[model samples]
Target: MTDVPRAVDRLDDLVSLDTGEIDRTIFSDQEIFDLEMKNIFGRAWLFLCHDTQIPKRGDFFEAPMGSDNVLVVRQRDGSIRAFLNTCSHRGNAVCRAEEGNVRNFMCTYHGWTFGLDGELVGVPGKSIFYKDKLDLSKHPLRKVAQLDTYRGFVFATFDETAPPLEDYLGATGRLGLDMIAERGDMEAVPGVQKFTVHTNWKFTVDNVFDYYHPQITHMSAFSVGLIPAPPDDFVEGGAKSDTGANLEVPFLPTDLHNFVVVGEYGHAISGPDQESLEVTAGTEPFAWRHKPEVEARLGRHGGRVAGHPHIFPSTWVTTNAQLSLRVPRSPDVTEIWWFSFRDRNSSADEQAASLDSQIHFFGPAGMLEQEDGENWAQSTLQTKGLKSREIPQLLKMGLGTSEVVKEDGLAFMDAPINEHAQLWTYHAWREWLRNPSWEELRERTIPRDRY
Candidate 1:
């Protein structure tokens, strides 16, 4: 017999992350991915479309929850609800359209129909076909375990045991959202930009926080001037001649500092000082940190966090103002969806310009993402081999050098961009795979501010 551990114990191996390295099997193993779907995606609060997308009664948007899908609908009373799209009678999807306004849904299989609230209201044959034996009132649509919205962004969870949405987001995740929300009267653009990539989902997640690859991986972007050339005075901290000699790259000014925030449930944020964006960018059109209120609300961490802020398991929020969801379709195939938002008060032209920036930065056609995806695809493929999978992936940037500090339910690192947040995320991942009670999970993952 194979000496396989229980699913819980196996998760430990999958999440075996230390300061300097992580196991390769986590990216290529089917068994480990299956457990992740159950213990992680199944229980955690997954981001859905914003409430504004379905403002009127009967409007709905379709969202994926792990392998399953759900319909996010707005009710007549203005509240929103989400339920599985599958029909209760025969398991066929009751709704087929990606999104639309509908008073009711009818399954094409048996003509089983349901009301806006997902209550069964019609059966094609009824008394004629079933002699009225069907208990219509007994089964309603399978509602999600919980659904909630904060700052106009909707999220849903599948486990009834999961913590409340706000509690789960904690401070770190909230800061990430706050960076976007404080932008203005912001709402999700009417439609999402969806695309697929043949790479492990973990690659997409890790890349969100990776600050080291830009100069080389995106050298083409720099060459083509998609991202502006560095200023004459820009200098990288301890950057080598090979890494820095290429151009007068506008280095993060000497005053720019990296601030990392680690929150409960594996969520975290990292960035350069909030004011750095304003002071360094000067009059650059792409600069987004000039607003005093945003800098103040973001506080010290916001000022220093130029790196991406991540809500663990799948959501990534960027300093340039974009949100990405990394959907795991399989062990080696993942879907990346981009949502671009702009202040409704901004002029239409301004909105278009903001969206243009988002598209160029990380969408399917994004210059930087194209390069990153290539590496991720090759990495996953190589890891499938016995010898290759045995080799460890490194995360050693600023490893033992990280000095963690704690405050207001967040653990932070004061040093220049370090891997502390990434390490913290893995630690929480191991605790979550064990499937502890919500209270225990919170206790185990809560930050102590120091490592």
Candidate 2:
């Protein structure tokens, strides 16, 4: 394995929190990407398969953790464990299938078998060729340093020194998951809609907190009524087309308030308030937030966050009962996995409707995702150009203007549609790339009084 690059020496030059500008090269640099796989993905608690995906003994689901793949297995003892998928003997994959129930995994390259608990169980020529000298206990598939679940979502980390899962999540991250968990008896839908986008993973991640691009990037969805359109009076911003003429652009209503919550380790929630969304999309879509019990749990501020919640690095929790994992395959390629959720107790019609909305809104065939993917691909493509890459990407929408308000163990901001959350994410990203201690990282990512 390659050593983690000393990228922190130029972190400030790469991402300037003071100016809200970021070096484009960070998106395309191979060295930087390698550093991320080691320093960020290797350390942070990454979401794996949900508990619902593997409930029975011997059931397993494959998930990506940086450049490595892991098998999350339900053990015979009614517990879960995860380990690297590679065979210990020859480094070949022990399991070929993506997910299934099996008594044991036997490597195809060499019939070295492993039990559901990831213990080496059998070796074809052990007695004859090896003379029974090989130690199976010491040669079991390498296990993850830590594994835990929150609300049903399984997460794992390769860094044993990493904080406990809950501390890692903090208030903002917990609220993000709570947004989905509080809905009802939620469970992962049958299939995970996955596809690849030729874009830097960071582009997909930062876009979660972006509310400014929708009116323009997803105009097709709005035109087709897939996404609710801005009211007639809401037309305020304009963008210059290739012809240099100004094209009318619809913007969210000026008075619409956006709620932003930033927490340690780069977790954030940002977008229009639930009241603002209801004003435009109607309250029926967000009726769950209004429930007395749910509202009490989400609290006043969290109850209003009708937007995307991002757990630093890659996990994104969408308001529409879906969680997306932006798996970085390369500097310019990312595999997008959509895990849709539904209330198991709901009527079949309601469950079908939920899946339909999840599919149409943000998956391989989703209209909004298709539009966003184009922009992200193009943005990443520009970073490779000698001249274009020199230009700094801007996130100056609401820089240094919003005051963070602390309430009920949460630090948040209420403002018009802005890029505070995106900027916050980049700031946290810079700190994370430095590979500081957990205590240092927490201090660095703590929400500032102002942005």
Query: How many clashing residue pairs, candidate 2?
Result: 1
Report the alpha-carbon TM-score of model 2 versus the true structure: 0.96
Task: List, residue by residue over 374-411, the lDDT tens digit for candidate 2.
Answer: 99999999999999999999998888889999988899
Give the alpha carbon lDDT tens digit for every residue of 105-166 in model 1: 89999889888898999988789988999899887899999999989989999998787899
The alpha-carbon deviation from the true structure for residue 264 of candidate 2, after best TM-score superposition, in angstroms, is 0.3
Model 2 spans > 4 angstroms off = 1-6, 239-247
Clashing residue pairs in all predictions, respectively, total 15, 1
TM-score of each candidate? 0.91, 0.96
Candidate-wise lDDT, in order: 0.79, 0.91
TM for candidate 1 is 0.91
